[model samples]
Target: MKLRPGGFSADRVLRKFLPRSLLGRSLLIVLVPLVLLQGVALLLFYGNHLNELSRRLAGGVAGEAGFMIDEIDRAPDMRSLIIQETDRYFQFTTVFLPNQVLRHLPPPDAPGPVDDDLARALGQEMHRPFNVAWNTAPDFIRINVQMVDGVLSIDVPRKRLYIGTFYLFLIWLIGTAGLLFGISALFLRTQVRGITRLATAAEAFGMGRDPGPIKPEGAIEVRRAATAFNRMQERLRRFLAQRTIMLAGVSHDLRTPLTRLRLSLAMLPEVEPGEMAEMTGDIAEMEQLIATYLSFARGEGSEQAVPTDVAMLLEDVAAAARRAGATIEIGAPEGLTATLRPEAMRRVLTNLIDNARRHAAHVWLSAAIHGRTLRVSIEDDGPGIPTSQRETVFRPFEAASPGGTGLGLAIARDIVGAHGGDIFLFDRPGGGLRVVIELPA
Candidate 1:
C-alpha cells in the first residue's frame, strides 16, 4: 500500500503484519489486538470462575464430611443416612469403616484400603473404602474413610483442578483468536475500499487513460491525495496548452517567410538552370520541413471530434496513395463507425502511408477491430527499422530516412496520444516495417 502525500494511511500500518495487501494488512492490525484482548478477557473470566468453583468444591467436601460425622454420632443406626446423604450431596461419594468390620450393607465386594492419610489424621484403624474419581483424570484415584470410633476421613482427588483450569484457558484462547481474526478481516475490507479505488485510479492514469478526475470523497488522507492529483492534472493541461501556443506561433512565423521565398524562387527559375534547380530543391525541402512543424503544432484540441466512418477515411487515404502510383491495399468494408477527429486521423494515416510508399515497393493499409479498440496498420515490404531506431523515429527531428523530415511520425504519435490512443512502429514478420494505430471503439 502506498501512503498519500499529505497524510499516512491505515493500510501502511496494516502492511507490517500482513505485508501483502491493504485489506490483509489492515485486518491483521485490527485482528492481533482484538485477539489479545479477547484472550485476556477469557483468561480473567475462566480464572475467576475456576477459582470460585475450586473454593466451593473444597468447602462442600469439608462440610459434608463434618455432617456425616455428626449424623453417625446422633444415631447408631444412622450410618445409612450418612451414606445416602453423601451420595446425594457430593459429586464423588464412598464409604469406609474399620477393617473388615465395615461392609457394604446392601451387598459384598472385596474390601478396599481406606485412605491412609485420612485414617492417620482421624486416629482410626484401617478400614475398607471404595474409590471415587471426579474432577481428576479417569485414571486418578481417591478414597473416603470412616474410623470405627466415628471419626470420618476423606481424600480429595488431586491434580483435577489444575488440569481443568489449564485446559479451559487453552480452549478459550483458540476460540477467541479465531473469532477475532474473522471479524477483523470483514471490518478491515470496508476500511480499505477507498484506498483500493485510489490505487486503481493512479494505475489507470499512469497507463495513459484519461480516467477523468477522482471523486475526492473518503478518509482525509485519500481525499487529500485525490485533490492533489486533480491539481497536478490541471497543471499538466496548462503546460500542454502553453506548449501548443508557443509551437503554433513559431510555425506561423517560420512558414510565412518560407512561403514568400518559395514564391520568389519560382519566379527566378530557368535562369541559372542547374544552380537554380539545386537551390530550389533545398528551399523546397526547407518548406516541407516548415510544413511538417506546422502540422505538429496543430495539436488534437484544434480538431473537433465526432462519430466518423473510419473505413471511409481509410479508403480515401488508400485511393490517394494509389493515384500516386503507390500499390496500397485498403482493408475493411465501408461504414465502420468510431469516435475520432476525422481530419486529424486522416492526416496521421496519410503520413504513415506516404512514408511507407517512399520506402517500399508495396504497402498495405488495413483496419480491423481489436477487442474494444479499432486498429489501423500500415505495413511495407522494405528494409525495416532497427530496434534502436523504432522509438527514435517517433521523436521530433529524428528522421528515419535520409531525405525524410522526421516530424511526420512524431506528429502522428502526438495526435494519437491526444485522442487517448496509441501508435507503435515495429518490424513486420518476415521483414519490412509495420505501424499500428490503436484507438478506442
Candidate 2:
C-alpha cells in the first residue's frame, strides 16, 4: 500500500506503542489484530445476544409484577394473597405501599446495556408509569409502579435478569484469546531469531571477522534471505582470495626482472656517471612503487583482532616519526583500549604519519573515544590538499605530491574499510591537512 504524506512521522508516532526488535514487532503483528477482533466480538455479543436475553428475563419479571398489580386492583382485600402467590411462583418480594405515595423515583445514572434493555422491556409491559432501579441493592432490581392511592414496589433478584451463558461465553473468549496470544508470541520469537542471526553474521563479515557457516532456519522467506546472504559472503571471500593471489604473482614476476636490471647497472664501471645515476634513480622509484602496490594488495594478512591500547599505538607512531627526523606531538588518554587488528592499525597510522612528515615539519597524532567509536587523527602544519582533490587522493595511483606512489591514502582507506571504519581528510583550521580515522570500539 502507498503511504500518505507524513508517513515517516506517523511511523515514528506508532513506534511509541510498537516495539523496536523483530521478535516484539512480529508478536505485535499477530496480537494487535487478534485483540481488536476479540474486542469487536465482545461488543457484538453484548450488544446483540446478551442484550436480547436480558430483555427477555426483564420482561418475564415485569409480567409477573403486572399480574400481581392487576389482582391487587381487582380486589384490594386480596393483596396479601397476590403477594404470597408471587413470592411462591416468581421468588420476588412484593411490598404494597397503601398510605405512602412515592413522589419521584430517579433514573439510573450509569446505565449499562442490560439496564437499558431491562428498562425498555419494563416500560412496554407496564401501562402505568414506573421507575426501575437496577442494582439499587447488590442482589436485587427494584421496580416502583405508580398507583392512585400508593406505589407497588417489586424487588426481583438480580440473578433472574442475568444470562449465565453470556458471562460463560465471555470467560471462554478471554481465556482462549490469552492462550492463543501466548502461543503466537512463542512462535514469533522463534521465527524472528533466524533474522537476528542473519544480521549478526552479516555485520561480522562486514567488519572482516569470521562468522562461521550460517545454518538457515525459520519460515521459508527468512530461510531464503539467509541463503542469499551466505552465497554473497562466500563469493566475496573467493574474489578477495583470487585478487590477492594474482597481485602477489604479478609483483613477484616484476621484481625478478627489476632485480636483474639493478645488478647489471651496478656492475657497469663508470659508463657515464650522470646517465648511470639517472637510470638508477628511475629504477629505485620503480621498486618503491612496486613495494607500495604489494603492500596495498596483501592487506594485513590473516591477522586476528585483539584488544589493543589506541593511545599506546599513537605514541608508538609518534616515536617512529620522531626517529625519522619529523617533529611530532601525541595527545591521548591513558589506557584507552579497543578491539582492533593491531598490525593493520599500525600500518594505517604509519602511512598517515609518514605522509604528514613528508609535507609538514610538525605533525600531531591524537586519539579519543566517542560513544561506541574511537577516533584517531593525524594533523600536519603543511600545505593542505584542496577540497576538490581530497576524494581523488584516496584513489590508487592518484598522488597529490611529487615522488609519492599515491597508494598511501588508498591503502589506509582499504584497511580502515575492512575493519568497518572510515578515514576522512579535512582542512585543518590553521592551513594544514587533518586525516581523521574512526573505528567501532
Candidate 3:
C-alpha cells in the first residue's frame, strides 16, 4: 500500500495521463479498441498466413536451382543445355560464368522474413559456396552458386516470394479502421456538445445569471440529461415565482393596517403635538422595518441579468449617502460594466454605503474592473467590526449595533452571492472598515 510514500499512486498516474475533456476521452475510448483489433488481425495474417506462404515459395525456387546443378554435375558437357532447359521451364534467367572464382563475400544484410527463409532453404538444398542478391533488382533475386568449373547465376522473379493480396488486405484494414474512427468522432462530438451546453447552463444558473432552456440534441441519454436540466431550471423559476407572489401578498396585507393607523393619527385633532410626532415616528419606523424584512426574504426578486455601468451605480449610491447628511468621497472610472441584476446590485450598494455612513465620520466609495471581475469597495472611518465578528455580522438578525436589524449585511451578501460574486470585510489601513464586493465582469 505504501510502496513509495507520497510519491505516486496507480490511480493518480492513470488520471494524470488520461484525456480531460469528454470529447477527447470519448475518441480515445473508440480508438484504443480499434487499434487493438487491427493489431491482432495484422499479427494473425503475417504470422500464420504470409510467413508460411513466403517459406513455401522460397523452398520451391531453391529446389529448382538444386536440380539444375545436379544435372550439370552428372554430364559436364551438357551444362549449357541444362541452364537453358531450366530457364525455359522455371522462367528464370540463367548463365554460367566460367573461370571466375567466387571469393569470400560479406554476410547477408537483406530485410524481411522472406529473404531469411529463402536463404535457409537454399543452404539446405545445395551444399556449396553461394551468394543471394535480394535487393540488386526490384523484380528479381540474383542467386550465385559456385560450381566445380565456374559459377551458376540464376535470376529468380521477386513475385515468387511475395503475394499482392497481402498489401491489399493491409490497405483495406487501415482504410476501414480510419473510416470507422472518423464516423465515431463525428457522432461523439455532437453528443459531447449537448453535455457541454447543459453544463454551461447549469453554471450560469448557479451564478444567478439566467441561461434559458438549452436545445436537447445528441444521443438518447445525452438528450435525456439535457431535458432534465431544462426541467430543473423551470421548476426553480416556478418555485421562486410562487414564493414572490405569496410574499407580495403578505407585504400588502401588513402595510394596509399600518397605512390605516397613519391616516387615523393624521386626523386626530385633539392629540398633543409632541405625542403625535412620536406616534408618527414609531409608525414610519415600523413600516420601514416591514419593508426591510420583506426585501431580505425576497432577495432581489427574479431580476434578469444585464450589463450595467457599475461606476455610475456607485456614484448614485454615494450621492444618496450625501443627501442623507453623510460626507462621502468617490472614485470610479467611466464605463466600468458588469453583468448583474441592476436593482439587486443597487440594494447591495445602498446597504453597504448606508452602513458605512451610520457610524463613520466619512465614507469612501470606489469601483474598478480587475481582469474579469468588478471590484467595488466601501471604506469608512467608522469602528471596524472585530475580525472574529466580521463573518458573524453577515448572519441574519446578528445585529452589530444596538437597534440595528442586522439584515443589511446579510441581504448585501445574499445579493452579491447571487451575482456569482463575493463580499469581503477587512480593516482599513488607518482605522476603519473596508467592505469589498467582487462581481464577475
The model with the greatest TM-score is 2
What TM-score fits each model? Answer: 0.54, 0.83, 0.81
Best by lDDT: 3
Candidate 2, 1-441: lDDT as tens digits: 777786757667887877888888888888889889999999998888877787787778878888887887898887888888888899998787876665565766533466776777777777788888764798888888887788888898988877678778889889989999999988887898899999999887777777866989999999999999989978877887887888889998998999999999989986798998999899988988888889898886456578898888888878888898999998999999998888889999999889999999899889999999999999999999998988998999988788888899899999899889999899999989999999998
Candidate 3 local lDDT, residue 313: 83
What overall lDDT, based on C-alpha atoms, would model 3 receive against the true structure? 0.89
Clash statistics: count for each candidate: 1, 0, 0
Candidate 1 per-residue lDDT, tens place, 1-441, comes to 656685777766665546677676677678778867876776676567655665554444445555565566677677777767665665445445445332233221211122223233323322233323332334333444445554233444454223465567678678778876778676666557767777777655543345567777657887888789888867766776788898878878887888788788779735677877887788878878777766776565545567888888988888888998899877886788887788889889888888888989999888888788989999999898888878888888878579877888888888788667899888898889999999877
Which segments of model 1 are wrong by more than 4 Å? 1-24, 40-215, 218-224, 258-287, 297-350, 364-378, 412-427, 435-441
- Model 1 Cα RMSD, 1 decimal: 11.0
Error of 1 at 5 (Å): 34
lDDT per residue (tens digit) for residues 43-156 in model 3: 999998988988999999999999988888899998888889899999899988988767655665554578889989999989998988876688898899998888888999
Ranking by lDDT: 3, 2, 1
